[model samples]
Target chain A: MVGVIFKHTLRHSWLQALYWGLGLGLMALLVVLVLPLMDYNKMAELIQNLPPFVRAAVGVGDDLEYAFSTEGMIAVGFFGKLALIFAVYPAVMGMRVIANEEDAGILDVVLTLPVRRWQVVLERFLAYLATLFIIAALVFLGLWAGAQLTGQALDLSKLAVSALNLLPTLTLVLVFTVFAGALFGRRTVALTAVTLFVVGSFALETVGGMAKGSAAEGLRSLSFFAYFDALGVMRSGLAAANVAVLVGAAAALLAAGLWAFQRRDVGV
Target chain B: MVQSDPIIQTENLTKVYTSRRSQTRALDRLNLSVQPGEIFGYLGPNGAGKTTTIRLLLDLIRPTAGRARIFGLDAQAHAVEIHRRVGFLPGELSLWRSLTGLQVIRHIANVRGMRDLRCAHQLAERLQLDLSKRVRDYSSGNRRKLGLVIAMMHEPELLILDEPTNGLDPLMQQEFNQMMREVRAEGRTVFLSSHVLGEVQAICDRVGILREGELRAVERVERLTHVDFRWVEMRFREDVPAAWRERLGDISGVSEVSIDGTTLRVRLQGDFDPLLRAVSGGYIRDLRVKEPTLEEIFLTFYDGDGKRAAQPERVKELA
Candidate 1:
């Protein structure tokens, strides 16, 4: 039954997933195409002289020195700065899982079937997780395609690792939306809450990076974006500890969502 | 063991919808039972908790204070197992509008782990539904037909339909009635909720009337249709007499009497022979005796004081 629902969800949503994947991939490719046309040494100087808040918003941290490199420019400008926009796809997918269906009264039909409530939620989540992986793979391909097009001697492994890092953070956002959906059982409420969380996390991370002192740092630690070190992973390598935290949080949210959904009235 | 038990039963089944401001007791403590091989019509007006009771039985919503059982199993605890044997059509049917009707059928069929599409295709053909069209393009009637097809294709042992004939034309309704009769013939049970009294009278063996979250009466259809009340219309040669209206009202078993032009209408209950004997010698042009509609019969159960004069033995407890 779980597999049936999983396949059904995939069949209905494959087009939406394709659009998100292609759009993000194209953006990455376009950024790579324009990277080499400018002088990085001057660009890096300008980025450093800019207001700290503005620089942080564009994902330029103390690693402005690496901002001169092709990998750094693409990582900061495309991946890090626009991470919230990429997170929107997962947010929408998560809400659509249960909350949107319940609001539409479609949950009434599905629940009357021989399948359990938890299976529907779990299977749909797994389907979305699979689509997220596909989107990440497409993004890596886009970065690789740009490297080939620009004739830059970039390490493909590093680009692959950078793209894969988006998964943990994106999964966290997706499951958080699912959690809110199960808890609230209203599409508008769940979507509003998830959007606030995503947008707020981005703003806090950017402001915390610019402000001085422990209080500011404490606020940054509270933001999910604080754990997603996109630039560091692109420039260096994968961090196991950060990935574990994100995955652990995502698993917890999903479990809580299943528990709430199983216990609550549907289509109320 | 299952054959001896009621196909559907509720013991003090209750549902209360609550919010920040107020709480509505949607379904009061309802105790009802429907045996196998009978079509049990759950009759009620809108907002009368018919849908609420059905939702409770399906376990779509939890009850505030009681439980429902199906096939001798707890509805909430063994819902999945019960669902395997039950077919349901919601009062307000909503499907995945983006998918073609065929796709929706295939999806639900797959979910039920059924490989065959023969039953689904047959039902669609019988219902005159085009499965190739996307549901968004389907008219309201077509959507209802699709819902019916989906609910019956699995051929479950129990069919729970809410407003099953809404939006269907007369021809389609007749066909649906025939389908229901066939299901009954196969010795399966159907628990359908409807405000359409004629459909209930035509197909149901028994009915339970619900009013404002309370089960008012449960009786066999034959008994209800044969309830003593009836309407008698007579055309007299030159108005009979103005004083006869008062005289007829004075007789036993005669309720309301009125004369409009040359036609005299009388509401009668029990033996009509007394009224017939009184009017036999009159210069009458014509006479018509009409059976009371289920609606009228139901009105008798909800009198001005909200009390039914002739309560069935089983429903006396509710009274």
Candidate 2:
């Protein structure tokens, strides 16, 4: 038989997946469309006029001329800042996978089935990952379509690599949210913890960029944002080490979540 | 014939909840055994640990001490295998609001690897539940019916039902009792927990009464019925003298005596020989006796002077 829990979880998430995918896609398309209207030289001059601290905090890199390139424009606008919107989808879904069901009294019925507790967590996590992947794919398609419509000669390989790289970053956040849910077993607490972590990491990364020292660099390394490397990936190719680190962290979080969930009482 | 092995067994099963400020024991060393092909009623008031025990048996929650076994297999170690042969209906039933009743049933059946849905459809028909309606639109009673259908559809070796008839109408309750009887006829075991005494009394062959986290008594239903008391009212043709009133009060196994003009009301327990003799001397115009409600009988077990309330001969107390 088709895994009943997996099938039901997918059915439960299809509409949500569609909404996030289309919404993120539209946002990416809109950001990319604005790129063709700007004058590269004038935009570079305007960015240079801004305060040094403001420029640093906003992640304006040394290669100002690259900002005019299709890859650069899409990276700075869509992947750097706009991808935060897509992060919310996976975070909320990860928390809902178990904690929300337990709160709503649905998990009591589910756990009584012949399936093991770990199976419940693993299946739901898989379903959530699939949805996140769909959203990311749609965003990539949107970037490609926008480049074609704007008549920009964007590097298709760079665009694909950059888009796929976002998954590991988002996956790390998603698994952390799942870990919080399993540990707390309360939606509000888990949600609050995840939101604080995401926001705090972004703030730390931004401040670390503006600061000048090894201390700041050390703090930045702690944030998942530092390793995202959307711009770097676009300029060069994919970095195997960054992907490995992200995938490894996500795997660790997933294992911890499963262990915690199995040992604790559910629907309490 | 019933199977010799116990279908469900708990050896000193216990559960404790510990917080920073306090610790509460929800179940205290409860040892219970239910035979195959028998309907075992777990009777208790709210918060009497009925749901706790049921959850432990299903392996939904870990026991703080001791363990539970089903079909001679450890509940925690062999949960999947045990669950395969058992169907459970939680006391507070909840479902996916988005799916129709039929879809919910089909999803559970699929999980159990059941290919035939004929039994599910038949159960829905008998319970008068509209499987096409979304679960969000279902009334509380309809939700209960849906739960029953899901639990009974597969005809498992054991059924663990917690407050199965809650929110059900009297007609539906009757149907549920009949369905339970049919389950028993198939040689299946049912572990039913409920606070409603009459329902348990009507259907259960034997019952375990719980109070304050302890199993107070386990006895045959018929034996319990005999221990219940009755209310008696008598009408005299004229105002009786104080001596006659004293005579009625002196009767054995009688209490709560009161007089209103020519009518006297009193509670009668056990034998009636002394009461009949006491009233034979008076010019009795009429007499009426009323059976005590189940609640009254329940209170008799927990009321003041607990030692006097518990009838040693009928109630078998666990150590």
Candidate 3:
């Protein structure tokens, strides 16, 4: 079923998948390929002159005070932030792949068939997952190539585990959009779901951080995106709990989408 | 006796479209039935709820009232099951621009769990359609042909075609009628919706005339042929005198009587023999007899000022 969906998508060039790969690929190339070769001493001097707020914002390494080695500069400068944006492209692109079908009146033709509506929804969601894999593979290869070029003591095992780490989490955003797509039957609903998801996540984090018990930490539990502790994945080599959270959320959201798809009247 | 159950049946079906400012009762308490192994003609003017009824049967839109059953199953609850055995051609042909005719058939076949590809090729050949080109580039007739092939390729038990012959040429229409006859011969049901009388009259076994969301008549094509109006034109040695008009007005069978110089053309209501004798009784002159075509019969129902038969209270409220 997933194969049929993937083949159907390729019948038309869903350019969003290509753009998603290139956008994340370019950012990875700039960080892993370029930053590791920059002057570490000069970066250290620049970090000293930078503002205190900017300095303390998101520290990726323990040695942010001095940019000493090529690996250290690359790690602190670009490593953690790249994954956040990488995860986002799949969600946004997934919306287009699913929502555009309804806007194009393709669903009218598709619904005429003997297949159930959820079959269409689930198949398209599986196609989006394939796109995520392709994009993730490109990013992984880029990272491996950069590590080989610099001869740094980069943990290939950790990176391999990290690559596996992104599969379900990235897929969650796509599934979430699919769930919302079923509810509204419009492209804007998918867009609105993505926006509200991002905004609500940050809002939960902010309110959690402001006061009280592990309430903020517990609220962080609500966001699938927040489970991606890059520092843990990068330094310790794996985050199994984070990956489970990603997989669980994705499955639940996709199940909701399938259920809603089966129940809602199409072409409304 | 139960074998007479129609393949498709609608019992007082209704659909209401409510927007912010206004509400349109698209289908209002309508009743109809379509039996198996025949071409059933569904005729109505524009905005007369024909399309809405099709949508409800297909589960594209929900009816506000009443029930519609296809193959003796609930129209909405058993949509997928019903769709599996039925093929539909929507009145508006909107296909994916990028897909070719071959691709369209393949996709529909795939979803329906069908494996017959060669049959689709054969249908395209019969319809005179070039299946290699993209749908966006296909002409109107070719586009309609694509839909026809898709609807027929599955070899389903029922075919629900809306305005099925919109873009076909005269020869193609004859071919289409032949194909419809073949389908009926195979003991399959075809529910065809169209406003053209001759087109429907040529193929349909029975027809339902819908006006203002109400069915005015549902009778066999044989009865329509029997009831078709005929015209009687007689030439007088002189102009029709005032006395002739007074004498002709008394006949119950003559619907309309008109005078053109020495030629007298009369529109017959039903049987022409009664009307013929009445007109030629006293007027000792030359007489010409002609058959009134279907178009003239249609005009009688659709009047100039939106007036129609003063029947069916539901029709009046809808009108």
lDDT for each candidate structure = 0.88, 0.84, 0.71
Choose 1 or 3, whichever is better by lDDT.
1
- Residues B1-319, model 2: lDDT tens digits: 3448888988899999888999889998989988889898998889989999998998878999989999999999999899889988888888999899999998888888898999999999999999999999999999999998888888899999999999999998999999999889899999999988778877888888787677767777776666547998988998755666677777777888888888888899878778888877679899999877755766675554333365545444332
Candidate 3 lDDT over residue span A1-268, tens digit each: 2245456765453566677666665665566667655676776677666654344344432355433454444444544455557657766656645566666666766666675677777776766777777777766676677777766676667666666566766787777777777776788777777778866765564444333365675886686656765555555555678787778887887788788766655555
Q: How many clashing pairs does model 1 include?
A: 0
Q: Can you rank all candidates by DockQ, best first?
A: 1, 2, 3
- In model 1, the Cα lDDT at residue A166 comes to 92
Candidate 1: tens digits of C-alpha lDDT, residues A1-268: 6599998898778888988999899888888888889899888888889977677767777778886688888778888878988899999899889888889888889999999999999999988988998899889888989989999878889889989999999999999999999999999999999989999988888878877465786798778888788889988788898888899999998999999989888888
Global CA lDDT of candidate 3, please?
Answer: 0.71
**Cα deviation of B212, candidate 1, in Å:** 1.4
Candidate 2's DockQ is 0.63
True interface contacts reproduced by each model, as a fraction? 0.80, 0.77, 0.39
